[model samples]
Target: MVTKTSADVVIVGTGVVGVVIAEQMLDAGHSVLMIEAGPRVSRAEVVENWRNSPLGVKGDTSVAYPSRPWAPHPMGGEKPEDAYLQFSGPDAYDQTFIRYAGGSTWHWAGTSWRLTPEDMRINSLYGVGRDWAFDYETLEPYYVRTEHKLGICGPADRTQQWPQTGTRSAPYPMPALPFSPGEVKFTEVVKTLGYNNIPVAQARNSGMPYDGRPACCGNNNCVPVCPVAAKYDAETALHRLEKKGATLLVDSVVYKVETSAQNKIEAVHFYDQHKQSHRISGKLFVLACNGLENPKLLLMSTDDRNPNGIANSSDQVGRNMMDHPARSFTVTTKEPFWSGIGPVVNSGIMETSQGSFRSEHAGAYFRYNNFARNRFVTFAALKKGLVGKALDEEIRRMTACTADIVAAHEILADPNNRLTLSDKKDWLGLPKPSIHYDVGDYVRKCWEVYSQPIGKQIAEAMGATDIKISPKFNNSKHIMGGTIMGKDASNSVVDVDCRAHDHENLFIPGGGAMAAGACGNSTITMVALALKAGDAMVDQMRGA
Candidate 1:
């Protein structure tokens, strides 16, 4: 095997979490080497691929980046027979993450949200899921740093801002983007029902450019691929890291993380595109490879001392898998709302996400989906055998009046919903990730008792004629809680600083290190955790 000993810090996964840490490490004058499993593709190539894709697969964001033979990820449209993740539970844990240079941020919705104090202390306050090792106050500064780094845009008004409890230390870098006509009308209609629809804080430019990237031009293609660099994808940070003198290895699938007799990570071994093995040594190693892959890599790297896994002393490396279990409904309104003008999702209902009721049932966040309905409506119209003027009229009517609302509920940490290495192997002969997931009764009750009723009321208040709610629960793709953090090392994989409890030199900072999956999007929180971990890593290296 080829060996290289050049990096001070080695990070697995070139996603946002990994790149964020790399940026901090490189800024502190430490040499960083990032290993990415997937191939690198330019923005032009991804946009061209999206444009050439079939209309049926346009909504599937993963269609822009097809999975490679060696480093596979979940695909949209027609799923391959030999998919990587094997799901065995009531609900399918079909996560859609690209194992590429920029990672899954390529198709992210760009929604940036900070967790409320209550969200972090659910176990202490509500006696539900496990509380974070530290409070939100400790992580607030990191949240501000993340917002500035990502160039987030949001409302400056205290009432309109999320949490609305004076948690923000600084105003958003940019003002909130103007709401689309559909969002404005939905806000007005929801007000009649005493429900507030607030503008979502998103990682996109509002009016003026802040970072090296340009302002958002409202192409309404935030998902799949943003043609312009307005959205904050890891590729932007990866470029910054490269310019700051960091090494990036693409198409390098890290299969094993080697540990010394002292239980500290020595090097990580990866397979190149040619399936040739190579090892890279570093002073500090980080596994930012998302929730699933991080634990899978650890479990796969079993040695004589740690027979279970590298950091599986507590047997919690791949336990307590959680995600935002969601349900959606479609409604046809009497008045035209015109949802095709701006970003796909501009606003959401956040007030419902926290309450004393969470102790009894799960709390949920609601989004007014603003995706253009022309493609979906046209397909329906054609299937109905409409000809000429009738088809055109139907399409226009449906496009103008249809509204799709989705409610994503917060799931408590359940150790039973876990990720394990499957007996089935991939093309590279590595074991595929096997997940057994159940949305749990809390989320199920939230859908039946709380979210469903509120959703019906909002639809009716908006003059909806026909409202159809989905019966089954679906995943929101916000993966969390695989490698959870807690004060006790026996029940947790990482500590308050996101450093692995078993290995001091190894850090696992991402959604995988999250203790609680709050109702809102978890990307911002993940970034905050990474920032905190980066600071700790810098200090540790300095002390060494």
Candidate 2:
């Protein structure tokens, strides 16, 4: 056991949120300490791991970056009990997240979509879900800050923006990447149905470089790992943060948060890789862990002062869980639409996500998945036991003709869709996270009444020879709404700035604080919230 020197701020989980906050604190001349539950590995190592992995495991996003037993996270195809996250629900919340120094962004597709103003006020306008404590206008500047920080590339034209109705304070940091042949075809075909496939804002360097990273080489392996450092992952900022004088402790799993008088966070207790416990006190604490992990950590840190858990007086720490429940349509187009030319996701039908029909059912955003089809088609050809030239021909034909359209529907926050501490324990004897999820009728209505009908139209318009829609909904893995934010303290875990209502010095930002799960990737919003909380932390440290 050891007691380390105190810092002005201590943040748990060195994901994008934690890194953003640490950088902000350093800029403000505040001493910062960041603790991560996973080991630090080089990009080359991850790329090599992906290369050496078997073809069957290549699709599993977490396969390349192996997990440490002490700090377990959900792997691709682990058994129910063996999995880090246990589940008991109609829908399986089998999310994939890495407990690494850079966090899950390492395996993400880097889609950065901003939520429209209507997205934040869904409850008031559509009579569904909880409205954000603040409006989109209040968070717009922070959105710009996050976009610039991440070097987001998007179209300069307002018409090509994800939500045409939303206003922007400034244009994206970089111009949008050109659509691949498949994406261009998808965009044109969808247009025949009065649907617009707008370019998606993404956190990747374009032709010109802004950040230290180079421009995208278009390898099309953005999911497992980008071979080149073109995409903006949290790991890309780690070196910059260390240069800024912020202390980052990798493999330091924070298990408990100690609170002092007035329910203020005094220090956090963590275990290193050796399982040796250590304590580091700080003026303020930020838990930027993902949606599932944040709630589990709070629930595990109960004490005499906090009978339920620290900063969980509202009993909403692990409740009101939400995510984008998605259904996919796979079709073989009449003409060859070669994918795998650029990023895995470049353009999407975002306009479909908004409409007055949202009052009756959740709206959905449709994306033409741009993943290379060779690997997928190869497996299918082998399953048929085709030999030599026959297999090669089948593989090539399937790769050229196949396409996938994903319909990610917005889901409302439901207390029943919850995350709780599990009875099962991990290698470190820590309680695992257990989840209960049901996409609910709102999303179901979208699939049956809204998304499926439009999907049929898209397939028919594309002159598809064969089409198949997935029967069940799958998670987009955009977890949100555990430590939900609101104006009232009783019903919410955090305030507008992501500060805990029960603890003044404690901040719980990121996806956990998102009040609504809009039909888009939630990383940008999470990072924006971190920036918002960062400003609040600076103000508090300055005695504002």
Computed on alpha carbons, the lDDT of every model, listed in order, comes to: 0.88, 0.90
lDDT of each residue in 1-544, candidate 1, tens digit only: 1124459999999999999999999889898999999899999999998998888878877778988888988876445356788888898888878898998888888998788999999999899989999988898999999999888899999899987643788888899989999999999999988889999999998998878898988898888778997988998777778888888898989999899989899999999888999999999999998789999999999998789997888899888888888888899999999887888778999999989998889998999988888866778878989899998898899999998999989999988889999998987889999999999998888888999999999989889999988778878889898889988999999999899899989999999888998889889999999999999999999994
Clashing pairs in 1: none
- TM-scores, each model vs. reference: 0.98, 0.98
Off by over 4 Å in 1: 1-5, 77-81
Model 2: how far residue 200 lies from native, Å: 0.7
Candidate 2, poorest ten consecutive residues by summed lDDT: 1-10
RMSD per prediction, one decimal? Answer: 1.7, 1.6
**Which whole-number lDDT from 0 to 100 does residue 13 have in model 1?**
93
Question: How many residue pairs of model 1 clash at the backbone?
Answer: 0
For model 1, the local distance difference test gives 0.88
